[model samples]
Target: MSKYKCIIFDCDGVLVDSEPTSIQVLVDIANAYGANIDLDYGMKHFKGSFFVACKQMIADLTQRELPDDLEAIYRVRSFEAFEKKMEAVDGVRDVIGNLNLPFCVASSGPESKIKLNLGLAGLLPFFKGKIFSCYALKKWKPDPAVFLWAAKTMGFKPEECLVVEDSLSGVRAAKAGGFDVFGYTAHDPENELQTLATKTFSKMDDLLALINNEMA
Candidate 1:
């Protein structure tokens, strides 16, 4: 029925609405350090890795070097804040529950952070050991390592998996992994997703329908 036997999901903007939470945390931390950070600026540099983004934000806003231990503090605080306020992106649960194929989460976030956020969002039980983090790989998103690792760990071939992603970086990673990709445009338009996605959808039901047709 379906061309793909496995489904790989991106965690941040895709499965859970963690991006806003992450940005707010970073902004709050930056302000605490006497650097006022803007969301747009954050979106430009902080989409992939938390530390990388944090360091960049520190440098950009303060024009000062970060203490070696600053990121460690930020990490702990971010996780604490995230765990307190994380929610699934609307419709993620319904779509995931409706799917018949094997699926797993692969994220650019740290493994611990991913697990914590997923748990807070109540999606942890569904993923468990199936979660893979790019931070564990040699490189981050837009590099195929994380997705490849996830597919391999789940015993699925790259071509046998479909990646559901919401960000450009995630889409690029899925493409680089040689898998079919569906861009989720929950906040953007299909035209915006066209650059990377083979197909695009804003609604979970629409994506599920397409999956059904593809697998049929």
Candidate 2:
């Protein structure tokens, strides 16, 4: 059987199908400001990155100073898009329902955003009081703090938890914190997650088996 005692989920792409919606909003807003990026470019470079990171990239792309409210505009627009378009990752509800282990979310999003997205996806109840946000720590992914905090709060060592992540930053953070992470590759266009994660799978339906050591 898999030795994991707890699961740490990344909220955006893993739990709620919000990455594309979120990134699309960023691309649209950035393009309006002359970033000139397409959806594919946003998905590749911005997925899992902090807003500041994406903002700096947009500034670099436009070769000019951006509005101070870039993030504010993004939050408002992205949440609006999410309200209309966000859904739970396919088969995630079933996995969360059937999995017989402890689990929680650790995301780079603000707690309000995480809760809003999860609530929209009908996943809020499963994660109530168990959500950890990097914003809460003023730390972003590739820093390991969020995952470390989640594992500790969930009462598991890093080695005893499996982090389900769909972003490069999330995978890197989990690994750096001494946790095994499964890269969820459903939206991956470049097949990058497989190279960095302990194991990579594309569907949530397969997760129960993967966690239970039923998949070889």
Candidate 3:
């Protein structure tokens, strides 16, 4: 049997390469406002939180309050681009499909946003209805409430679950939730995730090996 009965995946960098679409949407809005914002900031602060990034971007460049409709605008544009170009992370399907343990997604994004990205990547069907978003839990990630919620909803305990994540914030969330965590570094350099992760893997085959080993 697998060490854990269930696995929870973070959606963005873990299952899909949606950053390009996200970054482009942010840049498109910045251009509309004639604001000069660095793309690096988008990659860093903006990866997990949609509204936070919108407000921060306005503050960073224009030194002004974010427009009331900016969030809506960004959402619409992001979905448009996401539908066009989001691609599943390499090896995600093979690993997820072959895993013997039950799994679901616990993401820091809004539920609608998570569904959109998953649908775009064609990974939605794999998750069925097991997608849990941070927005529904009354707290966002780096807090662990979302993961805890997923575990509870799945009738599992934190210790009975394994979390696969790609970001420092996500690792912190999984740790806080008291779950075993495997940090994925496929989308980032080892140095980027090593400090936050207990163990890291650059490919899904390696992760499958570890999972199967744990089961064995």
Candidate 4:
């Protein structure tokens, strides 16, 4: 039997190459509004968060609230960007195709954004009914509620689930839910999740190997 009964994937950076695009859109919007938010700032504060966290971060940094339509604008622009450039993480498709256990996507993104990006990357079918969004759950990462809910709904105990995540907040959430987490470090050169994740890998092929080794 596999070591894990289920695998939970963080959608943006772990499953799809959408982080750079999404971060760029955030930076562009902030800069456009003269908030002076840059890529470094975004990577530090925005990588693992939802819209409410983002709004709070912006307010904390700029001392001003984001426009009410900011999410609407971001959705349109980011969807356009995803349509033109979104792709699944390297080797992720093959990993999913060959996986022996149940898997699902649990992300901080809204359901619409998750569907759009996954569809654009041609990964929608793999996780059609298995997608869990914090927006719909009303419990964001670092809270653990979403992951706990996913585990229950998927009929897996927390210890029987493994989380593949790319953000510190995500790792924290998975850990909080009592699940082992592998931190995907391709986009996190600074190793933010190194101390929290059970293990860290920079490539999907390596992640596959790690998973296999665990099962062995």
Q: What is the TM-score of each candidate against the true structure?
A: 0.88, 0.97, 0.90, 0.95
The reply for model 1, stretches above 4 Å from the true place, is 31-35, 57-61, 189-191
Error of 4 at 45 (Å): 1.6
Higher-TM-score candidate of 2 and 4: 2
lDDT of 1 by residue, 1-216 (tens): 777798899998888888877876777777777787677666555665547756776777787776788767777887887867789888889988888889999988888888888888899999978999877875787888999999999998898889998777778888888998999887553356777788988887687777767753
Residue 90 of model 1: what lDDT? 88
lDDT of 4 at 174: 94
Q: Count clashes in each candidate, considering only residues at least 3 apart in sequence or on different chains.
A: 2, 0, 0, 0
Indicate whether candidate 1 or candidate 4 has the larger TM-score: 4
Candidate 4 — what's its lDDT? 0.88
Ranking by TM-score: 2, 4, 3, 1
- For residue 134, what is the lDDT in candidate 1? 77
Candidate 4: pairs in clash:
none
Candidate 2: clashing pairs of residues? none
**Roughly what TM-score does model 3 have, to 2 decimal places?**
0.90
C-alpha-based local distance difference test score of model 2: 0.92
Tell me how far the alpha carbon of residue 172 in candidate 4 is from the true structure, in angstroms, after superposition. 0.4
Largest lDDT belongs to which candidate?
2
List RMSD in Å for every model shown: 2.3, 1.5, 2.1, 1.4
lDDT of 2 at 193: 88
lDDT of 3 at 49: 60
